[model samples]
Target: MAEASLLAASIAVLVGTVAILVNRVRTPAWVRDAQLTLNASAVTSLLLLVCGALLVALVLAFGIFLLATRHGVVGRAMVCLAATGIAHLGVTVRRH
Candidate 1:
């Protein structure tokens, strides 16, 4: 269980790092516009909003996964949930 959790966290970090790199290489139009037009405070608030939405989405995805899998693997599910939170925090920190 500990190994599974560690693996999930590692994968999440890798995914988050790749996402950040990709985003840096090719920013979306809306994000670019927001960065350009918004002040620091506004941008921070927007980031928070985006993070919140992402967290909700992650929770919903995990919930659906649990339902589909019949909740047979609680450890794996919990690891995934933790990974999602960690990845979100990583991206948020990178942005800041």
Candidate 2:
């Protein structure tokens, strides 16, 4: 579980970095005062991407650990759920 959490945290950091780059690329000048919309979108996207990555990574790590210890059902479920979350994030990123 602890290892899982660490993996999740790493994923979040990676996603956050990507988000920052995306924002930098999309944001434009001269709309500074009313750039609230862009700002909000960037923040929300960043958060969502990071959270999704974290959840997926954590579940995946947990599932792998369980498998290593020969815990079947629990391990499988975690892996499935993690894959689902990761897939969702992949779709979201592609859409944007």
Candidate 3:
């Protein structure tokens, strides 16, 4: 039962992260402006793409951690980190 709950929670976080990435990609200009405030316009787009890729990498890392680790402090910590990422993404999504 506990394992099931943990799996569900991990999946939810993965989905949320992907959703946020998709929404950000849909508005490249906004993402560039928001993420690279001081950078030149020419480079902002590339930087934004890097940021998106980084987020995708983070999600992948977290997913792998969740899958490969056993239920314990490490698992709980990963879940907490995932939740934090989701909440941060939620705020970012709302802002733009």
Candidate 4:
């Protein structure tokens, strides 16, 4: 599930990045406005991608931790949630 989420997120971010790059070369005001929209979309997609990647990283880390000593579901869950929140916050900050 985590891998699937990460894949989807990365694809979305990649698409958004491409769209932004395409829009950036335009010349008109209306076209520039449209590019701004693309920028917002790219930023949002990037945030989701970052969060998903972090979650995958956390899952791997927890898997290792489980092999070491005690199993901890709470810590892993916290890591995932924190990664998501931080990604969202980063997007919000970047937007403003």
**Ten contiguous residues with the weakest lDDT in model 2:** 29-38
Shift of residue 72 alpha carbon in model 4, Å: 12
Any runs in candidate 3 off by more than 4 Å, and if so which? 38-96
lDDT of 2 by residue, 5-66 (tens): 65566556556656654575455542343345435688787887898898889889998999
Candidate 3 lDDT, 1-96, residue by residue in tens? 776676667667767767776677679696677656534464655575557557755865775576577545446546555555655555454444
Across 58-96, the per-residue lDDT of candidate 4 in tens digits comes to: 655665565455444434444444444444444434444
lDDT of 3 at 80: 54
| Candidates' C-alpha lDDT | 0.60, 0.67, 0.60, 0.53
Every model's TM-score? 0.35, 0.56, 0.40, 0.32
RMSD of each candidate?
8.0, 10.9, 7.5, 10.0
Clashing pairs in 3: none
Using alpha carbons, what is the TM-score of model 2? 0.56
Using lDDT, give the best candidate's number. Answer: 2
Q: Supply the global lDDT for candidate 2.
A: 0.67
lDDT of 1 by residue, 1-96 (tens): 865565567567757766775576366774566455444686676787677767756765775676578663554555456555656555445454
